[model samples]
Target: MSEIIRRDPRAEWIARNRLHPLHAALQSQNQTVWIGPNGIVRKNPHAIAAGFIGPAGIKRIDRSGAQQGTGTRRSASVEVQLPLHVVEQPAYYVAVVPDMVGGRLSSHDKDLLGLARRLAGSEGAVLAVVFGEHKESAFDSAGVDRLLLLDGEQYQGYAPEQRVLALRAVDNQFAPRHWLLPDSRTGGGELGRRLAASLGERPATRVWQAEGERCVGRAGAGQQDIQRPLARLILAAAECAEPVSETRHEARPVELAWQVARNLPRIEDLGPVAVDPAQIPMAEAEFILSGGNGVKDWELFHRAASALGATEGASRVAVDDGHMPRSRQVGATGTWVTARVYLAVGISGAIQHLQGIGACDKVVAVNLDPGCDMIKRADLSVIGDSSAILQALIERVAAWRQEGRRDAA
Candidate 1:
C-alpha cells in the first residue's frame, strides 16, 4: 500500500529457515540492524568486535604486587554497541525458503547473480534466501543484506491473513523497496501478503520483471494497489511462476476465489462482500474439559464432552479406537492448545503428548492409577476409574448449568 516495489525475480534472496544464509552473507559485507523510527541502517559494532569476559579476581600475592579488580575492557577494545548501516543504502531482495518435505539443495552464485540482477534491477539490490531454519549464514554472514524471520507465536500455518501479518513485520523492520519470496507452497506467501497490507496495498499475484523501482505485474487485484500493473507492484511470490498459472510462459497472476484470498480487493460487479462468520471456539469459558485415550469409552467421552460444553480431543490411544476425529487429536503429533482450564480423563501422560498440549492455565487429571504421569502433572489429581469420574462430573455439571440458568433468569 505504501509504495509497491515489484519482485526482481532474478535478484531475490532466500532465507532458509532458522538460519538465513543469504542474510548472513549480506551481513558479512554490510552489517546493520534496522531501527524502525530512524528509517536508517545504523552500524552494529558488537557483531564485528570480539567477545568479552567480566572482571577477574584480585591475586593476593607479593607485597609489591597489589592486584585488585580487573577491568574487562582491553586497551584496543571497541565500544559495546554494534555498528549500524544506513537504511536503503544497498537494496536487498528476498527468496522465500520455507521448510520443505525433502532433501537439501542450493543454487550457484551465477544463478543467484542472475536472479539478483533480474529482480533487483537496481545496482545495489542483491539476492538473499528466506526460510524458517537451517540458514546460519543469512543471519551471521554477509551475502544477504536483510534476514526476514516469518515465524512468530501467533503463527500456526500460512493459511489465510496470517501470511500478511508475517510480511508486514519484516517490511516494518526494514523498508525494502524490493522483497522477493519463492513461488513454493512452503515459501513465505503469508509474510508477503502481510507486508502488502501494511503499505495499505494488496499484492500482485504474478510478476515478471522490475524495471528500476517500478514492478511490472500481471493485471488483477494489483491494479487497485498500484498506479499501473506495469508500474510498482506487491506480491506473495509462491513459485518460480504463479500457482494459478498452468503454463510458465503464459503465466498470469494467481487469482484466488474471494473466499480463499481474504486479502483480495473488492470491486463492483464482483458481487457484494460477505463477512465471514466468527469462529466460535465451542464455549465462552476459557476452561476446557478434554477427552483423551484414557476416557476408555467413546459414548462416555462424547456424552461428558457435550455436558461440559467442551470439544473432544484425543491422545494416541483414543484415536485408534475411533473415539475422536483426526482434527480433535492432541499430542506431539497432534494439536497444540493453551486453554485456561484443562481436564484430562483417563490419560496417562506421555512426554510426547504432554509436549503437545501442556501449555494450559490449569490442568486437572482424574485417573485410576495414582502413579500415572498425568496425575503428577495435573494441578488437581482425582484418582478413580475414568467412567466413574465422568459419571460424577456430569451430575455436577448438570446442576451447575441449571443454577446458572436460574441465576440468569
Candidate 2:
C-alpha cells in the first residue's frame, strides 16, 4: 500500500491572501484611492484612512506614507446621486412592512432587518416602510437607518389594495432598488408579486442569500435555486433566523401624504373572526402532529395530537381524502409550517410535503415502512404502525400522570 500525503490547509489560505486585490492596491504607492462617486482623492491621507476604517480609526501617515499614530476619526464624505427625470436615485435599502398579526413582529421581520443591514454595509442606509402599528424603538434597536411610518386607520387591516397604495406612495418618494418583504401566509408574497407586476420589475421569492447585487433562492415547485441581479427593482421574500442583538440607531419618521391616503379605494372592514386555539392554522403552529395517507382513522390522529398538545396537520392525501381540512394540509400546495417540533405520522414524505416542513426545527416520524422518505428525513424514526404507536404513547403519558398523582398522595 502506498502512503498518502496530505496538503496543508494554510497553503490554500496563503495563496488566497496573496491573490487579494487589496494587498496589491496597498503595495502600490502611486495608486490613488477614490473616496466616492466623483472618484476624487483627498489630499489629507487621514481622510483616505477614514474611508476604509469607517470614520472611527484615523491613522496619521508620515511623509514617507507610513503610519505614525492613531487620532480621532471623522465621518467620511460620500456624495449621493440625485434622482433625475424618468430615472430615480437608487435606494440604499428598503424593507416593506406587513401587517404583523397579533401586534407582534415575527422571525420574518427580524430577518428582513438582518438582510437590510448586510446589504446596506457601511455606504447605504437601511429604510423600513411601516403600514400598521410598529414600535419605533423596536426598529431603532434593530438598526433601521430610516423608518417611513404610514400609521392611521386607512393603513390598518389585511387589505392588499391599501398595502399596494401605501407601497406605491413610498416608491414614488424613494424609488428603492431593492425591496425586502416577509415570506408568510399573510399576504406579503402576494403583495410583493402584485407590486412587482404593477411596477414592471422582476421579483425574487423566498430568498435565503444575497451577495452584492445577486440574490439566490428557490424559484418554483421544483425548488430550483436561481440567482438574479439587484440592479433593477428587486423584491425578495425574507426567510430569516432568530434575531441577534445589533447596534441601535435613532429612527427618523417619514410622513405619508394625505392625498395618497385619500385616493385609495374604499373597502369595508369586517371584524375579526372567532377561532378555536385547538383549530389553529398549521402554518403558525409551534408543535404539529401531522397525518398522511397511511393514517386510516382520523379520530385516532386527532386524539394523538390532543394527547401530545400539538396542532393537527395533514399531508395532501389525507386532506384530499377528507380526513382533515384543507387549512391543515402541509405541502407545496398547502400551508408551510415553521414548527418547533413536527411529528409526522404515516407519511411517506413526498418532496412537496418536505418543502412545507423546511423550517421545522425537528421532525419525528412514525411509519410501518422503515425505508420511507419521512423516516429518512426524521430526526427520530419509529418503525411501527402510526395508530398503534400513538395509542401506546397516549397510554404511557396517562400512566405517567397517574403515577405522579399516586406519588403525590
Winning candidate number (TM-score):
2
Which residue runs of candidate 1 sit more than 4 Å off their true CA positions?
1-287
Q: Could you tell me how far off, in angstroms, the CA of residue 87 lies in candidate 1 after the best superposition?
A: 33
Cα lDDT tens digits, model 1, 1-409, are: 7654455433334321212224334444332244433355654434322223211111112223232233232222332222332225445444333323221222222222233335543335342433333423322212333334434323333333545544454445434555554332334355445445666665554544445555544455545333244222234232222111111111011211222123442322333354321222422224456676567676876778777766556676777677766666667777776555678887887776677665555788887878777776788999888888888878999999899999999
The lDDT for every candidate, in the order shown, is 0.47, 0.67
In model 2, the runs with Cα more than 4 Å from the true position are 1-93, 135-137, 231-244, 263-267, 281-283, 286-409
Which of the numbered candidates is closest to the native, going by highest lDDT? 2
Model 1 alpha-carbon miss at residue 274, Å: 20
Clashing residue pairs, backbone N/CA/C < 3 A, model 2:
none
- C-alpha displacement of 135 in model 2, angstroms? 5.4
Weakest 10 consecutive residues, lDDT, candidate 2?
80-89
